[model samples]
Target chain A: MATRVSPAAEDREQEGDIVERCRGFMCPPVTDINVLQGSKEEMRTRMEMLIMETQAEFCRALQEVDGGTFKVDRWDRKEGGGGISCVMQDGKVFEKAGVNVSVVFGHLTEEAAKQMRSRGKVLKGKDGKLPFCAMGVSSVIHPKNPHIPTVHFNYRYFEIEEEDGAKQWWFGGGTDLTPVYVNKEDAFQFHNTLKEACDKHHSQYYPDFKKWCDRYFYIRHRGETRGIGGIFFDDLDSPSQEEAFSFVKSCAGTVVPCYLPIVYKHLNDSFTDEEKDWQQVRRGRYVEFNLVYDRGVKFGLATPGSRIESILMSLPLTARWEYMHEPAKGSLEAEMLEVLRNPKEWV
Target chain B: MATRVSPAAEDREQEGDIVERCRGFMCPPVTDINVLQGSKEEMRTRMEMLIMETQAEFCRALQEVDGGTFKVDRWDRKEGGGGISCVMQDGKVFEKAGVNVSVVFGHLTEEAAKQMRSRGKVLKGKDGKLPFCAMGVSSVIHPKNPHIPTVHFNYRYFEIEEEDGAKQWWFGGGTDLTPVYVNKEDAFQFHNTLKEACDKHHSQYYPDFKKWCDRYFYIRHRGETRGIGGIFFDDLDSPSQEEAFSFVKSCAGTVVPCYLPIVYKHLNDSFTDEEKDWQQVRRGRYVEFNLVYDRGVKFGLATPGSRIESILMSLPLTARWEYMHEPAKGSLEAEMLEVLRNPKEWV
Candidate 1:
């Protein structure tokens, strides 16, 4: 009798080859190697691969500037799927930096469904629960130099399957900058780089997403934006899935280019103790925005088996809260505060 | 020519005398001195007076131990009320201490009314708006010594008038402790003091309120209580209005006594830098509890024209966040974590 091989076995063998070829990712992909390899043409596989690549690239770029290596943690959720978290703390130039990628699979609870409905998503599930797959790469980098602004970005792809087998998918992400001291040239360069990325995709992407960023990152109680605006857009199920993916990829690629120039310029800049204190005060506001109002953080906290370390890695290593702390009039700190209170067009 | 004084004029004259008699408060009460003195027999006036007195006493007691005087700010809210905020930052013994009292009058927004309804309050109003008066004294003291522990307490009374002229009144407040290290003796003394206060009014009060405190101060995402429990109660309108007032007074009175002994014992204790770092880490959780889950903080941030400084005064002067920070097994930090993970019956 001739030796025979089942198609599933053949797929697994081929997957093993692919997995070997794809070594040096932050870790093994959260999705099964076989599934990832067999579904080479699927959007889920493509997104997963993209985030892994983006996370590694970003971490390496940051490492090059900071002269520090990231400590990586690969974690699994008992419910389903898992994530990879990389953090660099107390580095030479960076105070704390975290880059994370998670591939999660779960059923949306009724409460989560309700929140989605409020956000204008329509669902056709009898029990208000739907199976979903979500993958994302998120990061926040807090540098030691006060002159170098803290930068944050996250890009995610999500798919939900209703009871009737109807499927819906969307992509979301943004990049934002928060500087301790206003540097007009750096702001111009940052926004111009992002604008160039957006213009390549769509003429309206920069303006629309920049406005969305201002709105979304608002610290309402303080009547100020979290930082100078960048670009923020969500629920983008646009012209086509391929086009949406292209746009997200463009945004994700711009993070290092947009931020590293400022970092390099300020990495060696001398700062006063007063300036450092002011930076800590601003970090306090950053903490308030994340803990009080960040949607991703709220969702992560609510989700069972969520990796909290990854979720809260965005916070600075140290922060301060001085009651009624206010910058004196006509000072550099006040100028920055003014910009935060009234967001400016950078490009 | 005997002055034919109108009754209103006579009341004003008498009120001025009463106001002068109440001169030693932290500052003039948030309520108008005339209204506060003239309405002395009303629950509104009584509650305001009690809070004003409580704030002054607490501030004085803390100042005595810390050897630092509070910087007082009497702020007016444009919409309808004002507050007196007393804060001492970077004191010798205390890192940050704030005691605040506010008397507010406003129409409850639909969102606030809905929150109350969800909490099992029977709110009746037209268009979900009800006129209300609220007064409270709140304090959070963070000591410099890691061994001393941090203490937070609040006492408030509220009254609402429905469109149909129905009135509803209630009292709410609690006291809790957060320690960097577990000291069983301190825990016992703290709980015993609270138990004595609760027992004076009702035998079941200690058990019921202690459980409520544990539940209320929970940091759910961390799967731990904020600290060792004390006493917490809300919507206490039963037995009789007078009786409820008496109970609130008793609880408020115990704060100084319950906390000071611990402070005195640890005031001059030597601690290593490592211990201080751990304390900062614990303060980060305190920040999480207040900013993320504290109901009063949520309400304060939501209210328009609310004084942000007063609301955020509960935060510590400094705090720290470390990625996936865990204590060594069998360490004092681990022992404290065990108590937080599983709250104990101290009294």
Candidate 2:
């Protein structure tokens, strides 16, 4: 340039524009501002920006309902990249709500690769390590009211560069509902909203992904599903990247409509101490499923420089484990247990 | 006039004597009374009797301290043997206490054999299956008082028969403590009790097994040991089977002495709500360790026909998880966290 401007100076000048555009985000993008601005067309940048937007929107929606602001922690990994974790604890409605978005870059580990293989991903890495980038938004909202079912969702994008400089990418995620007490109307509304989102992309997505969700969230030792199914899919390298991204966008965008109406309906409903106890006990099963069998949790725990606080933010604020706890016959709790034992099609 | 007693009648005659001898047990042994009477000399029978006795004694000690009696469930496994689960929940002093004894006989799955091999056991099976017999006494006591700490212990013996008609066997177990508040005296007392028991068998037993315990109970993601170190050993087929049994007995016998005094000392200590919250948070860590890293728990969950309630009875009655819950600088909780992060020699 005639003025001889340094690249660093140029980056600094653009950072202000980046920050302004990212104002609604829970925090700044995990990637460097200059990198984000320069690589706006890249999928990694697009995914990062998407997750940041999703996290902010989700947090704002929760705040409006709970009258509690999220306490945000912007954390960096020693290896590479970082994340923003926003938690609303002990709110008027929500007991513990966490929304997290992370953009991570590192060498893919053998363990992580093996896990991906089990999920049917194919990759050829040099010396069992591949340069990779992962970005995702994950959330779990545990409400104080027993009648308001717990909801969980995660959407992620992954890319790996092989020794030959070949880029391989995929997308994965799901949305599910867990209720302390079974409500037909709530289940219908939740599943119907998810089904509608899926139908926008493909007719088969709802049925196929709902079945996948049931199988994925099973508590095998207890012979029960984690909750009534919604939709789950992984390794979505479909007809086109744009189409898959559009599908995921539709699913993520429906979170508020899918969950908030159930919350609004049950927010004022009265519940007994026994119902609360049942919720705690159900939370115990949640802990068991996540810790014992969840692939994402195992991968996070195994990964070097992974943020555990964000990974384990999926757990409920409080849980209970009682020896041989069982619901009495013909009780509402028992009815819910029956549905958990046998998942039903909602839509 | 010899009465020409049939085998069934003879078993009934011996069952009377068996019931009389088992009067003090929480429940009758898992093995059939007749099989037990006939195979009194067999290692499987002896181990079953030993664990039943240990379970009964441990339950009684806990009851004496908490003024709560255990509710016992004697259950049978359709495939092979059965178990006795004794739980004292919502006690005055103890929040939850469980003592379980099981004598299981089955064709060991490849998974179980793989776990055993990881523990350095040399196992040769036919078609990845071996007929195995296992009997164990396991207990976890969560005291209500934050200062009292939680204690867990298990003692077990395993015997496997190879396809070549050769028998292989070993003994494994440990005792450990987790405290919400750090007390040097309590740690010292607990470790010294275990060290004394270990020294009775071998001079190096305490140091070696204590290190093993620290390694075994580690919560890797948190970079902390589950508790202060104690004696932990597996595959203890030492100079002789009798010697190993004696060593295991000594370690198991010290449980009451090692933990009860700590309970009594802190039983009356007044704790604020914050302290109670801290205890709940620590229990969350305990849950993390048990669910994520405990080999026994993994084996139990993976094994078919395993009793889920009995296996998970090691969990606390109530536990709490909070996002980024860090103890204040130089606080008591921080002090405990430091020791957990860097395990200290107490004996």
Candidate 3:
């Protein structure tokens, strides 16, 4: 049984306080329509710079909470000039985590574009070929402390061409968290923050996208979920490309206010070693569900350009099995098992 | 992946030089078939005496090897009616081991008999409501030194009524072994020893029964036989009950001579800690395959009268999953994996 947690109600509660009342906040700052639809070189430069800025924004938020610096391990600029991979590890709050955001825009190979067109997952041009480009910002945060709860968020835009190398564009991104222990208020605040960001774009956005997020991370074999969800939307098209790009940015921008505070409030002394062990066992189940049943894992493994390490980074350190074990009666472990067996709508 | 190692063959090789083979010394003396088919009460008393004698024989063998006496912590007989359970712990040659062999024969409940009749797993009476008694002698030897290899063998006999009780008859027993390591010559010897015993009855007995033993202990999930096969046959009815009884005795008499010397020779000073650890891990896998998938486990769990611990006694100590691990490039682990992926005729 999977229960979808919607971010809409949470967003409605947060917008008045967070977005409207916050100081030093910039709203509807500028409108640069042509900045999104100019020459190919300009579009590539704009997307690349935006990816770096988004990554920098994420790093800055982590530094603020933990007061720990991060070392940029790798930043590989694309060979044909499209994207960058910025990786980091060993933070005070995060043992080993990667915050990667990519923006790669290029003309798609005919074969590749053709497959995408068949799925109706991409746009195509006249003359029977697609002039394509794509941009994506994906990040995964695996925390050292099980209590802090790991989170993931990604925002992307795709475009396919016209005969003159022109293209149509769209936007997509959402964020979600996976907590070992439920913190009702923390979850509420996290979803609420994203909901407010989404509400500004469309009232229906938060609920629709939150359901999408929940459905996206389900591990079917065990009949559970990867995490409590946030919001997700894809293949978003707008007659106004600038509006779509701004909406995607707003979704990405909500991650800091939503997730960072929750981590700060919970990362310290919130759990015991026993809970940690329970978390590991749960993680082992997660690994099994992912490797054996997850569609994302299948898709990533099948995709030619995937990095194995990055794909498997979510696995935990240790797990155990004692023959015919049932969690001790009246224990927190039992409580967790009950919750897992019968999922509940937390938001 | 589980591999079969025959302790039977090793025993056969050592049996050649023995002064008094078990079959030659014992079976000839117990020639009064009338004495064996006494009243139920008389038979129970006699079987208890046999149990004590066999337990004594096992203890003596252990003492001879260790040069010191081993103590049974407790020996308890069943209150209603049955043999004793002689348990020992932390002994020189054995640890956490029980050399228990029970011979309890009785009338089955009408329901149980009917169920048995429907399943056709075992023999049933002509009336369809089985009126019979069964006596099974089984032992599981889990030596402290995994290098010594765990061994299991069982022999039994059953006699049931004809429709009007006018033509009641009897059948015999067979024994087999399970070892942790591969001992090719030991396996060959084991099979040959059983063959010699069967030769006293008929030539076809060895080959036919040997295949039965091989098929019986096979763990389907593992796609491999449990150990080097021994001889197995049930209800060996020929023209007369005397013929069936003789065949049964021939098979039962093979066990001690076929297995004792092999155990004595390989009990100590032949294995390393690494090998022991490997055995433990293999046992862990055995435990998994059993608990999760084995038919016996299912039957035991489902059976209303089953003793859970006794049923679960087959589990081993440890197991592991090293992340995304494929065995080394060219190693026994790889070979085992290959065999597990594809089963074959080792014999």
Candidate number with greatest lDDT: 1
Report lDDT per candidate.
0.88, 0.86, 0.54
Q: How well does model 3 score by local distance difference test?
A: 0.54
Q: Give per-residue CA lDDT, model 2, range A1-347, as digits (tens).
A: 01211122111112235556688788778888788889876778777877887889889989998998999999999998888999999999999999989888899877777877887877888776799998899999999999999999999999999878899998999899999988999999999999877776677788889999999999999999999978999999875776777777777888888998898898899989999999999999999999999989998998777889999999999999988998999999999999999999887
Error (Å) of candidate 1 at residue A174 is 0.8
Please identify which of the two predictions, 1 or 2, would achieve the higher TM-score against the true structure: 1
- TM-score order, best first, reads 1, 2, 3
TM-score-better candidate, 2 vs 3:
2
TM-scores for all candidates? Answer: 0.93, 0.93, 0.47
Model 1 Cα lDDT, one tens digit per residue, A26-53: 7788888898889987888888887887
Candidate 1, superposed: residue stretches over 4 Å from native: A1-21, A126-129, A163-166, B1-17, B126-129, B163-166
Please provide, for model 1 over B1-347, each residue's C-alpha lDDT reduced to its tens digit, 9 standing for 90 to 100: 12211222111212335576579798778777887767878888878877887888888899998888999999988878889999999999999999999988889878888888998988878776799988899999999999999999999999999879988999999998888999999999999999887776677888889999999999999999989979888998877887788778888888889999999989889999989999999999999999999999999998888999999999999999999999999999999999999999987
Q: Model 1: how many Å of interface RMSD? A: 0.5
- Give the per-residue lDDT of model 3 (tens digit) for B1-347: 12212223322222221223333321221213343434323433233334444555665565565555543322222321233333444456654344444443345556555654674545535645555555544555556665465655555555566556643444544566555555556666676777777766666677777777667656443455555557766555564654554455455556566776776767665667666555554554454344444444555455444444444434432233222334566765455545434433344
Worst 10-residue lDDT window, candidate 1 chain A: A4-13
Against the correct fold, how does model 1 do in TM-score?
0.93
